[model samples]
Target chain A: MARNSSLVFEGRQTQLKPLFPEDVTQEYVSWLKDPGVNEFLEARFKKHTLATQRAYVRGFDQKTKFLWGIFDKKTKKHIGVITLYDIHPMHKYANYGYLIGNKKYWGTGAAQEAIALVFDFAFLKLRIRSISTGAYAPNVASVFNYKKMGLSYQGTFKERLLYKGAFVDQVWYGITRDEWLSRRKKLAF
Target chain B: MSTEERIKSIMADSLEVDRTLIKDNASIYTIAQWDSLQHLRLVMALQEEFGMRFGDREIPDLVSFAAIQEAITKKMKSHGKE
Candidate 1:
């Protein structure tokens, strides 16, 4: 909340606002607890309650990480979260993870719009050299969106993650500041 | 059958819709059954039927029937299958 000098990363259909502790509502906690919504999220491993999430929101290191709530423009309802974390100032890089808790927004270009804002901030404002992220191999829709964001497939860590009952490979993707800049210039956006 | 017709049939089968319904302009926005997850299945179905692979990055552009046909055509031309 403190680091958002602009206070918002506005997109066409969604906006990214600081996800402070007070923003942790019952519905938000429910999304974390929902198995379907959390299947690909690392947070799925831990049982989420209102207290734990609120605490997690409060204790985040704003200097090194940012947690933003992705809200639907029409309802102003929080649909999901996008996080930029593990920022290394000297290296000028960071990693990202996101979730679209509301299934209605899936494949509707909402996530692509919201994540573009993350790139707009991290690469343009922070001057981050590169941003990298990993996705569950089974999550084709998410991986597809990552690719649409111009994050090229970097590599795969075989059986590096656990799913419902067994192991699954995790695929990595990344994009540099220069690459992102060029892609955005060409894209309709 | 032409590759385009084959693709239309595959799309119809994977989504459990009549082939006539999937017009050239039809897309995820128009098809109720072509949800995000179902779209993944459609990709797999098309790949399996065509015996070609699509890059993850190439997926987002294949939202409409025409786009899918164009991609498959481009892929076929690249492989000298057309």
Candidate 2:
């Protein structure tokens, strides 16, 4: 398979490439429908169709939001998706999210590398001051990975998300440009 | 405890399983309780126990008991311990 030449950023283990409409396959739709994959995601609350995914991909714009497919460099397979959304040029900040839809890649640090690449883009190229995100408190992997990536805890909304029959806290996290710069040298590329 | 035993104990504690179930070769696939979330907790526990921070590149290779043992050994050696 040919490498997606439109890769916007490269990391140690994964690359971030533009998510084109054609990249929305049945497999992608299936991932969204997979309860195991979507349980921690808001996407689990809704059904996803290929048509809807295609339209979502087609709606990507760099101004307000940027979506990218997380591709494994060694296997050259698209494993997940990452996005820097709610970008505000005036505020110089954004909120981000990521999903490693492939279970095989979970806990493998692929998400961490993808997150580092996004931070590089947000802080270096786009000159974003602060990048914020949130994770359900019960999602241990998301919480651990976000903290490991140097995102400081901002606050939490009590019983913000109804998950698995109980309401869970939604914890917010963010990292500023200065924070990223100070820690970038130690982080794996 | 030896490095292997230490790793097994950490894994068992993190996954809330009996320590006897975590053999030298036990891995994420082999252990029912060692799911993805537990894996991160295992990593965090290992880090706290060893006082060593694992790089992102090193985290993926630590799925199995032997791998964790080897990684901890290497890290300990680098820190002039063991």
Candidate 3:
């Protein structure tokens, strides 16, 4: 496929395409199993295998839950995954989640760009009203990315997640379509 | 200010540490406040102060004060600012 034609959503540094069962690879399974990579993700709690990943890829409904693989535009390397799930059409809302499986891409703006592309798709194309997400308090990177993208802190579930033999808070964040639109405008200017 | 000093100053301000504590070799692993989030903030500050943008490829390598300074210098030179 042509470079630009293949991308469902293209950002400056990252391109996102719908994930398929064929896209599942041993690397993807390894990312799920890597303790350091999944330190803050719920997936870390479970053992992942190629069969499970293939099944997970086939499980998305496409409407209520959409998954996309993030790729580096320059390298054309699949580095991560992003999903918009738990969609409520009547309420025009959904939940967002993402993981940068490639350690090399961490701390780069790939996560932020991939997220911005997803927000554009959610609010503009799907007409989603609000998008919600959360992160473990100790996962400072996730929390900071959400906040930087203009998601407002909703609340915290105190001692909701157990990590390293102790409890940690889960911080919730939400952004309405209006808020995202305005934020996009500000960023453009 | 020199590029090194300016880089240290931005790192100090972004991470909320004393400028003196921001050594050339200081990095996220070495500085308590220079966590992942603060690292992004520091990157943004450097971009704004130096009037240059860093490609995503450059971000991961820009972990330490010296690395940031070197990157900025190279970018500035490429832009013919140096």
Candidate 4:
């Protein structure tokens, strides 16, 4: 089995399972297209149709990137999406991203659980040296979440991305496997 | 000084927030520095000061200043800190 294949990650107070084919739906795609939802998509993925969402979800696997659908165990509801993208086995690292689409779950530590699980996968299973991520400068929540995950701020790239109609900077953050190992118990999901 | 006083001092310094803002019943998420990373740092700081270690259960329960105080008190008692 691949790392995190059993889809049984214990989050802070919830659980994270692999995103199955069934999780893909027009409803989710509609949310993906909502301006409020895609505000941080960086223009390229801002306007995803159901078909595009389907393709994106279908492509996630051991071959491409790992995607997981976050869930609230107590409420038993889907809370968000998280993925380890740009997985490079040779370099032993990947890019991480997640969004708690259900605003109701925002500020509830559900995202924290999702993030902790991602780190667990990256450091324990993949044996990656480091995981990298960037938050669009305007996405304060994203930046806050990454910082909470113990990622160190690298720098900001001005006009790094074009979203909607204007260019925006992206703030980079990264954490190494050694850091994860040193702080694993404290950051445990 | 009381353990609570020491912890509040630590919070005031590390979180860079007003000590008055911290309440015994406040949620851990209320503080800007009570984040995940800072939570770890807090645990390390507390461990160094109090000469104690925290388990996973203690971590989840240590979500607030009061919670940390409670956990530390419990540990201190069990270890004969008095």
Candidate 5:
């Protein structure tokens, strides 16, 4: 449980380090408040201020929930965040989520590198066997990113979420350690 | 057919578009059919067609027709296919 203290995940373009509550900044809170940014996130429902964002950041004890700031290596700027939560010891699986908070970082491969780093960390470092995540069906970009990441389509939860107007399905994705290991090099994470 | 022709064929087949639409400036961002999902399929197609693999980092950059052509060229050159 004392592991990953000062942990840093080094990727080609992105560098990830554990985020403390104090690391939560005003800009970070604004990312949550931006409707364009949190369009598919449940956070859109909430009023996000510095206090709320810091409290959320403080909740990641790293025993169960882990959080890291995704920094751009070249600029050393915190571009977004990635998290692995709800770790189950016996089951050896965890749920994953990420956001490229800085819109300028979008489509710059920052998101992909951030995802690959966390997945590698969970599978290889944490010794987790499987990692899973879900996306709104209308979020075609997210669904497809998971595909390129080598995660298998697990299933669909029908009408699982309300989008702009009507209900939409939620698509689940998952990958096991062996599956990731086999593909990582060729995929070059 | 030549390697470039074959590459275009795979792109056309995978993206369900005419081979001619894959022009010099044709790009994943510009093409309606070349979404993220199709991009993966297109990458797979290129890999199968060229018998080469792209690094995970390279995959995202291989968006444009010219970029993909360049990647394949470099890979082919490394393998002496060029």
Candidate 6:
């Protein structure tokens, strides 16, 4: 529907942009369905036929879940995905998620750039009061990434997710708008 | 005895690993326990030991021991400790 405008969040050496339908169909779904890639993800979509994939992308755009395709400005490659889901307009808050889907880009701080962009949107544009997210307690990498974005661990949700025949505890974390503004000392220009 | 050795001690302690494993250029990603939370702890430890604080521009860049050393060196030089 193209309801939203193309917004770019620039970092020291990277940039973030909202994902268009074209990019979603071309790359996003394939990346998501990769077994090794989707290991940490809870829901697995079956059989992405041409029609199904197209419909999936369109459906995603229709939701309030804003998805951003992360790119490395230097290489101009689509490295990962990040999203602000479960948006609460009245409360000015959302639940967020991200993944550096590309193995080559892991440990490169590109995810951090994507997160900084989300922070920019939440605090600078949307005026969101808080953003919350949860990670499987065993997913150390995701937990580490969240904390790096200044999110404080709230608590553990015991057996919150059943994945791969086992119930996984979730560690919930969040950062308030006021806390973000106060902690943010660098205005990356 | 040397600046490098002192830095290694700090790294070993902060990372909660063997001193011998902490090379001169070891980074947070290279160590298991040196994740983001530990990263913050390391920064605070350095501040306490050196009696200094880092500005926003430097925190993200302080991922490696070499980077930390450079930051500390710069702070020291600014204070005329070098």
RMSD of each: 5.8, 10.1, 11.6, 11.7, 10.6, 10.6
Q: Best to worst by DockQ, what's the order?
A: 1, 2, 5, 6, 3, 4
Local accuracy of candidate 5 as per-residue lDDT tens digits, B1-82: 8777777788888888888898778775445456565677788889987889886446756767788889999988989988
lDDT of 1 by residue, A19-125 (tens): 89988999989888888888888788898889999998886655568888999988898999888998897999899988888878776667777778889899988
Better by lDDT, candidate 3 or 1: 1
Q: How well is each residue in A84-179 modelled by candidate 6, as lDDT tens digits?
A: 878887988888888777777765567776787788787787788899998776666666666556677788888888767888788788999877
- In candidate 6 the C-alpha lDDT for residue A169 amounts to 82
Superposed by TM-score, candidate 5 places the C-alpha of residue A87 at a distance from the truth, in angstroms, of: 0.6
Selected candidate, larger DockQ, 1 vs 5: 1
DockQ for every prediction shown: 0.19, 0.10, 0.07, 0.04, 0.09, 0.08
Tell me the TM-score of model 1. 0.77
Best by DockQ: 1
Q: Estimate, for each residue in B14-75, the C-alpha lDDT of model 6 and write its tens digit.
A: 76789988887687545645655456567677888788887533564577778888888888
lDDT of 2 at A58: 79
Which runs of model 5 end up more than 4 angstroms from their true locations? A1-6, B1-82
What TM-score against the true fold does each predicted structure earn? 0.77, 0.71, 0.71, 0.66, 0.71, 0.67
Task: Assess the local accuracy of residue B80 in candidate 1 as a C-alpha lDDT between 0 and 100.
Answer: 95
Say which prediction, candidate 2 or candidate 5, comes out ahead on lDDT. 5
CAPRI accuracy category, model 5: incorrect
Query: Native-contact fraction for each model?
Result: 0.15, 0.12, 0.07, 0.03, 0.10, 0.07
Q: After superposition, how far is residue A83 of candidate 1 from its true place, in Å?
A: 0.2
Which residue pairs in model 4 clash with each other?
none
What is candidate 5's lDDT per residue for A89-132, written digit by digit as tens?
A: 89999999999889988766777778888888888888999999
> Against the true structure, what is model 6's DockQ?
0.08
lDDT by residue for model 3 (A79-183), tens: 999999988979989999999999998766688778888899899888999999988877766765665677887898999999889998888999999999887
On lDDT, the candidate that comes out on top is: 5
In model 4, how large is the Cα lDDT of residue A158?
A: 89
